[model samples]
Target: MPLTRVALLKGKSRAYRKAILDGVYKAMREAFDVPEGDLFMLIDEYKPSNFLYGETYLGIERDDDLVIIQITANNTRTTEKKKALYAKIVELLGEDPGIKPENIFINLVEVQKENWSFGNGIAQYG
Candidate 1:
């Protein structure tokens, strides 16, 4: 099982967000051989002022886009899958939203089965 978490700065249309998520899931499923049912995706939206680039917030008056994706997996396959997914995301967003690839950051975390719970007090896959 794998979990992908995404966080983005505000101002993007719902359609844009959907496209990115769809691309990510597709890439993950194909690259990592993850079952669709085991894929968990979460998106968090935040205001531009909430995210900083340097000494200033992302976008002041204009639209500023920043995306962060975190992937949690149990092995090396997870890492490769996340790398592919992140590349796909960057490509999609760059083509459609005109966002620079440099603005996106991706992180991968490997953890033991005991670290997560799906529901009903039951642990997920080991």
Candidate 2:
């Protein structure tokens, strides 16, 4: 299971937002082996004044179009899978929303399977 959060500058069209979510879900499915229809994603749009980041960090040039994606998932994917997920996300977003590869930033929060509850007062994966 994975919970994803996407943060971006406000004022994007609804279609753009949908594309972002779809792109991420597709990437996770292909690279992370996420099950179908298991999406749990939230998108947060912030005003430029409220969102702050380095224009160029670690030699990566980021712009106002930058999207920060964070995912909390089971700590099971291999290094190759993680890298593939990142690349697939970039590719999908670039194809649809026209986001540059450099403008995409991703962070993974790994956790144990038993950490999830998924409702019913029970740990689904545990």
Candidate 3:
């Protein structure tokens, strides 16, 4: 399971935001091999003054449309799979919301499966 947090500049339309969530979830299902109904995602909007980044970090020029996505999940995926997941997220988001490739930022936080407790004080995936 993956818990995704998406941060972007405020003032986007509801459809645009939904597209981001849908694109990320679709990519996780296709590339991360996430099971159906495992969706857990959040989106946070920040004002331009509050959101800051290097406009030309690593030779990639980012614009105001930049989106920052951070995902936390079990540390069970191989390196190759992780790469695929990132690529897929960009691809899907690009196709839907038309976000520029250079504007997409993703961070993955991996943890032991036992770290998650779905409900009732039980580590469901552990």
Query: Which candidate comes out best when scored by lDDT?
Result: 2
Relative to the true structure, candidate 2 reaches a TM of: 0.98
Per-residue C-alpha lDDT of model 3 across residues 1-126, encoded as one tens digit per residue: 799999999999999999999999999999998999998999999999999999999999999999999999999999999999999999999998999999999999999999999889999988
Candidate 3 is scored at a TM of 0.98
Candidate 1 ranges with C-alpha deviation above 4 Å: 54-63, 76-82, 92-99
Question: Against the true structure, candidate 1 has what lDDT?
Answer: 0.71
Model 3: pairs clashing at backbone N, Cα or C within 3 Å: none
Q: Give the whole-model CA lDDT for all candidates, comma-separated.
A: 0.71, 0.96, 0.95
Clashes of 1: 0
Model 2 residue 1 distance off true place after TM-score fit, in angstroms: 1.2
Please, what are the lDDT tens digits per residue for candidate 2 over residues 86-118? Answer: 999999999999899999999999999999998
Q: Write the per-residue lDDT of candidate 1 for residues 1-126, one digit (tens) a residue.
A: 678888888767888888767766776676667677776888888876676654234543322565777878776564565677677767766776566776666787888878778888877664
Which scores better on TM-score, 1 or 3? 3
Error of 2 at 119 (Å): 1.2
lDDT of 2: 0.96
TM-score of each: 0.73, 0.98, 0.98
